[model samples]
Target: MTDSGEKESAESMLAEIEKKITDAFEIFDHEANKTVDVREIGTIVRSLGCCPSEGELHDMLAEIEEEEPTGYIRFEKFLPMMTHVLMERRYKPSPEDQLLRAFEVLDQDKKGCLSQEEITKYMTEEGEPFTQEEMDEFLSAAVDPDRGVVLYKDYVSLMAIEET
Candidate 1:
């Protein structure tokens, strides 16, 4: 494609993405007043599959002040906040439920933990098996060596803390 053609393509794609973000925002703007309750902002963003960390959400919220005493975010503020997030490819963490469900599948015994051997087998034999070094790095933080197991729920919580 020509340079001009590629530029147009990029512009159109951005326009389409903005349109979708507007549509999602409108879902919460039930009154059609171009604003939505401040509290619903996080839910709306998450519903659109954006996984912004809590700090990022706070920053976004800080950028937009509510116009009324009741607290709301005007669509004008929401659009660009969401646009930058999407365009920059930010906020891609998997939801907690997803992480838990994946661990649940591997914890066949439903004991809320996985043995070291089980973790090693899955991490080494499963999809995109980790290299010995990678596995070592992963396990160093993911396991409780004294207990010889990983309480996945605790580990996931720990990861969530560190991720932000």
Candidate 2:
């Protein structure tokens, strides 16, 4: 494509992205105040199909606010932050981080480990529940035989090893 064509394509892509962000803002700005609070920000990020860790979400919010006082983020300000997150998602993928976050969600008690019962509950609630055999296999691979729990570190290491 020519330089002009490339520039036009870039502009079009940006416009489309902006439109999607605007639509999301409208959907999540529940109060119709044209702004989203910190809690709503998490919902918005998840609504976009991104599962950022709690720390990541906090960091993102901090980066968005800078030194400003805690308050709602106007759509105008949120747009750039959302764009940056999307860029980071594209350039620096972190499946490990996502997995850890998922584990954390399952480890509801903040126990640093998931017991067989916990895994079963989560998988069952996830809508195509795991079969008994699949559940047993997953538990065997993920859980520590001695502790009978899937520690966070073990889970992360196992997932990383599998990736390679």
Candidate 3:
């Protein structure tokens, strides 16, 4: 496709995203004022199924405050920033299918569960490598002492429930 065509496609996508963000903004902007409390930004983004960490959300808010420090964001000012954020996929949770696939790789015997040792190794040695404390916290929630294994499918389901 020509450069102009690609540009047009990108613009079209941005418009669609802008529409969605505007709708969400209106969900909180009940006065129809085209502005929302800056603090509500996190809730809005999460409602759209994005999972930016608190630090990341703070960074996003910082960029906004650099432009306008009113403790609120107007739609006109918010659209471009939010469009860039969503387009860039700055922060997104791992999809459930990917989580299940990772567990599948560790299951070896297709048991839909992982031995305590297997999970420990993966958490401590894999990409980004969780700290012992982080792994311990996760284990405390996911493991039942008597089982000696994490039923990852059930664990993931619980995570989904907690999210909702």
Could you tell me which 10 consecutive residues in candidate 2 have the lowest summed lDDT?
155-164
lDDT of 1: 0.82
Model 2 C-alpha lDDT per residue in residues 14-44, reported as the tens digit of each score: 7877787789889978899878776688768
Q: What lDDT would candidate 2 get against the real structure?
A: 0.73
Please say which candidate is ahead in TM-score: 2 or 3.
Answer: 3
lDDT of prediction 3: 0.79
Model 1 worst lDDT window (10 residues): 155-164
Runs in model 1 deviating more than 4 A are 67-70, 95-164
What are the clashing pairs of model 3?
Answer: none
Candidate 3 lDDT for residue 6 = 93
> How close is every model to the real structure, measured as TM-score?
0.57, 0.54, 0.57
How does model 3 score by TM-score?
0.57
Clashes of each: 0, 0, 0
Candidate 3 per-residue C-alpha lDDT over 106-128 given as tens digits, one digit per residue, 9 for 90 to 100: 88899878887899998889775
lDDT (Cα, tens digit) per residue for candidate 1, span 24-103: 88888989999999888888887666766657788889887664446888899788878888787677666677788899
Ranked candidates (TM-score, high to low): 3, 1, 2
> Candidate 2 clashing pairs?
none
